[model samples]
Target: MKDTNHPLPVIVEQAELTLAGLQTTMSLAHNTTMQLWQTFGPLKKSIHNKSNGGSYSVQCYADNFMSIPFTPETKFVKWAAVAVFNEDDIPKELEVLKIPKGKWAVFSYKGTISDFGKFAQYVYQEWLPSSGYQLDHRPHYEFMASDYLGPNHPDAQEEVWIPIV
Candidate 1:
């Protein structure tokens, strides 16, 4: 694990996504997200719009957001989504999520996905409190590139975006 004390930089942008997944508690998030990928993978071609900066699969955590403490019992929504050029013509089974323009603390994570919890712990429990920034009311997410390998792949890389104010 690398030093998570420092984040990359803050960025603000509007994101349009088409997601298909489940609403689960923190304890079940890992398994749930994996299941989401398995279910969404075969449907990727159908859900993605080529004009929307290619397809970027994402995991969005929302619900209580920053208003409540994060625990195993906390409920949140997790999605396996692809970016889309337009909101029209969305598949009936999928849900659309728009991440409004806001500041984010972007952290580059390199390693297996299973270790992500530790990184997140560092970010929320340590980094955020001391960084002089407050958590913004938005979905926290992870942006995985199209070429991303599975959780155990050694070279896997992803960016964890924590919405902040």
Candidate 2:
């Protein structure tokens, strides 16, 4: 069921990471990604001992997440964060998430954030099912750096990271 236009992902092994930022409960139907980033973006300077990898937008799904269709009400934790060297001095307003080293599939995409639904649909419904790798329980995320042009810009580019076993 692979679509000829679908982009393939790059499989890689990533090291463990400790991220410091803000988290919220949300779903596709109730997406607040823009607002979250809007609030967190300027605060990045307040973070200490951060990594040079830029900003990380992470989604932590429930254990049964992949087993069922992703509905609007399907709740998950969305974190707007940056990698930190350690959790010793986090801002009181932010929390830390420690991601263990794991295998992941990285997809590079360029488009407005609003247009990402189709891309995700293709990945989870087609590419993932057809590929040999299964979704791992770890969190999924997007990495955006100097190239990121913001949410509304169609030229915005980011690397989508999907945890896989």
Candidate 3:
């Protein structure tokens, strides 16, 4: 079996992004992102201005989320979205999100989505510590496309994008 781990990131100046999709309040302690996506996937066709064929999984941490004893209700904003040209095509119940241009460190992730915890640990604990870049205030997101079969697919692929200063 292929080892699941995170390698170094490719630094880049990400362009501003405009997106529209479902939004909810959740915590990583009891992640319900997949459930959110399950609801969003079938309705994706309703979005008429898709800028790309891929989707983005975005997380905006709560201000106090880093506090000790983060719990299931820590409250973070989760988005299962896709890039769009504008909000004109968005569904009535969906929300719009705008990500400003910023510097980011993007890592290529492979293997099942369940391995993300370990992969994230490697990125935040091992890689970030020596990467000379600190986390930025923007949301962290993943760009999934081509090889993205499903969350549990052994050969799934995605780009983990971490905002950096």
Candidate 4:
């Protein structure tokens, strides 16, 4: 198992996102995420000036927040987005997502993007159950810096933000 000795920090954040992506199942998330990035990637430069800060690529697991123990068939909304300063000037092709203020369990992940599932498994199955906190009702997300390499890059780094109560 990956290291779980250190305690992950919890934080609260407010975010405004401009997204172009898809709604899909966990089993299909990988392909769908790639598609979203492909569709939204080229538009990145045009949207940066209006961004709030670092770009955010997020996953909203349900229409309303739900507890854990989700299955592979669970539906979720995946987005390739950037943090926008405001909702204004959003392109017609994109959607705006506002992440409400809430507490989050933040984990620093450095590896191939495909390995995220393993880390997530560790979080939910191992760490979270023993951590004394429950998963909160909010979207989970990945914060990617402007210089972030693609998913398959060897040295890719990002933060996995899991909403927690």
lDDT agreement of model 4 with the native: 0.69
Query: Against the true structure, what is each candidate's TM-score?
Result: 0.78, 0.92, 0.89, 0.80
Candidate 1 residues lying further than 4 Å off, grouped into runs, are 1-26, 51-68
Model 4 over residues 1-165: C-alpha lDDT tens digits? 346643465565545334433334444423466666777766765664455445677777764444555666566777777876676676666766777777788888878877777877788888888788888767788988878886798789888888887
Q: What C-alpha lDDT, on a 0 to 100 scale, does residue 54 get in candidate 2? A: 83
What are the lDDT figures for the candidates, one per model? 0.64, 0.88, 0.84, 0.69
Error of 3 at 46 (Å): 0.8
Candidate 3 root-mean-square deviation in Å: 3.1
Query: Which residue pairs come into collision in candidate 1?
Result: none
Ranking under lDDT, best-scoring first? 2, 3, 4, 1
- Local lDDT at 65 for model 2: 83
Candidate 2: stretches off by over 4 Å: 1-4
Error in Å for residue 75 of model 3: 2.9
Q: How many backbone clashes does candidate 4 have?
A: 1
Better of 3 and 4 by TM-score: 3
* Candidate 2 C-alpha lDDT tens digits along 12-109: 99999899998999888898878998888778888878877589999999998888877888999999999988987888888899988999999988
Question: In model 3, what lDDT does residue 40 have?
Answer: 95
